[model samples]
Target: MPKGSGKVLAQNKKAGFDYFIEETIEAGLVLNGTEIKSIRQGKVQLKDSFILIRNGEAWISNMHINTYEQGNIFNHDPLRVRKLLLHKKQINQLRVDVKRDGYTIVPLKMYIKDGYAKLLIGLGKGKKNYDKRADLKKKEANREMARAVKAKNQF
Candidate 1:
């Protein structure tokens, strides 16, 4: 139902590679007219973007939404601290979790749902080098097994 409500624009693939995602949260973003237009045009970047909770409020930084082509002087900054809309209870929960060491909030995806911009953020812990290697080895082994089964079935 959530997927049906919105069209995804961009995703941060690097987030998964660099961190072990522990939990996911859906939050709304506050955007201006031109900023929304720009996002709808697929002119957005999530690389190196992250979320922070400060003073009982949540903010997303380093996320770039390109200026709308048609808007002059009124277009929003490409990278700004955009406020994330979430219930007080949700915010409080996230605030508590984020205070834990080695945990962070990473932007996972940007999408338009019900005519509004939404941010998918994840609570993640940085993965060690060996952990990444182990994941890669597992994926490779799975791929190899799949290929062997497919080849045998085709014979």
Candidate 2:
């Protein structure tokens, strides 16, 4: 397999805009059979998901995984809190980082790796409104510069 290649199920694009990501850690999800099926169908949402470390384990809350269409009454809850498997030392470090003001754990991406569901969680600091605006302005400036270069090259 190519390096870093996986079937991505969902990504939280807003996570970057809303927070300054410091570090990312890969964790495994505790998913039911139906949940995995739905994920394979690309029916997962990570926009509102956040990770919390409690009692030495990591838990992800507010992530939505739509029920599998062909699933019967055995379907798992779509909005259930899911456990994330991480090393004890990693969880302890994340807990300490999160204790700092303005810092939180955010779910950045979900994908299937080596036939197993995996989540990429980020340790981030929340961005203020002004920070968001500044980022947008910088993005716009870069876009304009790229456009100018393209036009000049065509001449």
Predicted structure 2, TM vs. truth: 0.93
Candidate 1, residue 153: how far the Cα is off, in Å: 5.7
Tens-place lDDT digits, model 2, residues 1-155: 53224888899999999999999888899999999999988999999888888788999999999998999999999999999999999999999999999999999998899999888889999999999999999999999999999999999
lDDT, each prediction:
0.89, 0.92
User: In candidate 1, residue 98 scores what lDDT?
Assistant: 80
lDDT of 1 at 102: 88
Candidate 1 per-residue C-alpha lDDT over 45-150 given as tens digits, one digit per residue, 9 for 90 to 100:
9998989888889999999999999999888988988999989988899888888998889989988887888888889999989998998999899999999999
- Displacement of residue 128 (Cα, Å) in model 1 is 0.8
Which pairs, if any, clash in model 1?
none
Cα displacement (Å) at residue 12, model 1: 1.2
Looking at model 2, residue 133 earns an lDDT score of: 100
Where in model 1 is the C-alpha error above 4 Å? 3-5, 149-155
